[model samples]
Target: MRDQDVEPFFATLQAANPSPETELEYTSVFELLAAVLLSAQATDAGVNKATRRLFPVAGTPQAILDLGLERLEESIRTIGLYRTKARNLLATCRILVDQHGGEVPRTRDALEALPGVGRKTANVVLNVAFGEATMAVDTHIFRVSNRTGLAPGKDPLEVEHKLLERVPAKYLHDAHHWLILHGRYVCVARLPQCWRCAVRAYCDYEPKTPPPGDRAG
Candidate 1:
């Protein structure tokens, strides 16, 4: 999309939902980290289903360590790659407790040092938990960025940098959330629901799909 349209595009999204948030449920920074770590290749709804049961019992780093590996695996078994995620979470908790006094770190370097916490996961934690203007370019965000012509790039890191450079400062902090939500519900991988999209006017996608009733038989 043109630089001129960027502001209005975000403005439209902000007007539709002023306070967008991550779909993953969490009440604390640590819990948020855990949820994001477990969310790889899994749906937010699925992670929520498992975390709803796990967090209550072992919400803290120490408590999660105390829960032990076997039980931790059992708690999140419903999610894909449970064994690997469980190991990573436990290792991360160990680092949090042993190195950071059981508190989630604030810096990108520190956050990514933990197992299962890559650049994208670190970005999400930094943005959602610490109010940083970092973009966690997930599948949804990646698709939306390229599809909308907002910040197209060959890779997520490239897209992230493009977004950081292109997005206005006022919308930088929450831009990822808006894009993710739009991609998830409207500008999906399949035929985009452009007919009802609020920001369809600003999007660069061509030959916008018509509503079912309007499609040619």
Candidate 2:
């Protein structure tokens, strides 16, 4: 999309959903971190299902460590790659407890140092937990960024950089949530529901798909 169109595109999104948030259910920063860790290659709904069961029993870093590897694995076994994620969670908990005094780290470097935490995960924690203007580009954001001509890039990092530079400062903090929700429910991967997209007027996607059974509209 043209640089000029970027504002309205986001403006439209903001107007539709003024207060977008991550779908993953969490009551605290640590819970948010764990939920994002478990969310890899899995749906928010799926992650929530497991976390709903796990967090109440073991939400804090110390509680999780005390839960032990075997039990942690069993708790999140419903998610994909449960064993690796369990090990990573336990290891990360140890670091948080031993190094950070059981509190989630605030800096990107500190957050990334934990096991199972990568650039994307760090970005999410920084943005959502700490209110930073960071973008955690996922498959949905990648698709929406490219598909909408919003901030197209070959990789998530590139897209993230572009978005940071291009997105209006006013919308930067919440842009990530808007894009993800748009891609998830409106500009879907299979066939974009353009006919009903709130920002269709500002989008760059052409020949917008019409309502069902009316592709030529």
Candidate 3:
């Protein structure tokens, strides 16, 4: 995409939703980081459902440590990879308590050092928690980026780097939210809802999904 296209793309997205935010439900950065970690291979609704109860009782690192791995696992066992996620979350909380004064770290290195916190998870935490301009390339963003020619790349890291360079400064902060929402609702994996897409005009995708019952209108 061109420089001009970058600005207009974000303009349309921003116009549709003036204040976009991550769907992951959390009251604090620690909660947000924990939520993102558990969200891997899981849906927002699933993560929210699990965290709603967990956060109230044990959101902080010390609190989570108190909850213990067994209880934590039971809380989020409803979601996939719950066992692994529980272990990672517990370990991460321990690290945060011992190393970072029980606070969620702002730097990527610090965040990534936590168990289960990968590049994508760190990016999400950094962007949402710290207002950093980082892109978390999930399946939805990966598909949308390549399909729309927004920042086409074979891998998530490649797409993330390209997006960092190409995405305009004005849109950098909210790019993750906008793209995730768009990919989740409009530019879907199976059948894109082209009719409802707000940025369809700027999208460079060929053979766009036809409107329902169009009869070649």
Best by lDDT: 1
Candidate 2 residues 1-217, lDDT tens each? 8888888888889999999999999999999999999999999999999999999999999999999999999999999999999999999999999999999999999999999999999999999999999999999999999998888899999999998999999999999999999999999999999999988887889889989987555
Estimate the Cα RMSD of every predicted model relative to the unseen true structure.
0.7, 1.3, 1.6
lDDT of 1 by residue, 109-178 (tens): 9999999999999999999999999999999999999998999999999999999999999998999999
In model 2, what lDDT does residue 147 have?
Answer: 91
Superior candidate under lDDT, 1 versus 3: 1
Off by over 4 Å in 3: 215-217
At residue 141, what lDDT does model 3 achieve? Answer: 93
What's the count of clashing pairs in each model shown? 1, 1, 0
Best by TM-score: 1
TM-score of 2: 0.97
TM-score versus the correct structure, for each prediction: 0.98, 0.97, 0.96
Cα lDDT of model 3 by residue, 160-210, tens digit = 999998898888999988999999999999988887788888888867788
Runs in model 2 with CA error above 4 Å?
Answer: none
lDDT of 1 at 46: 99
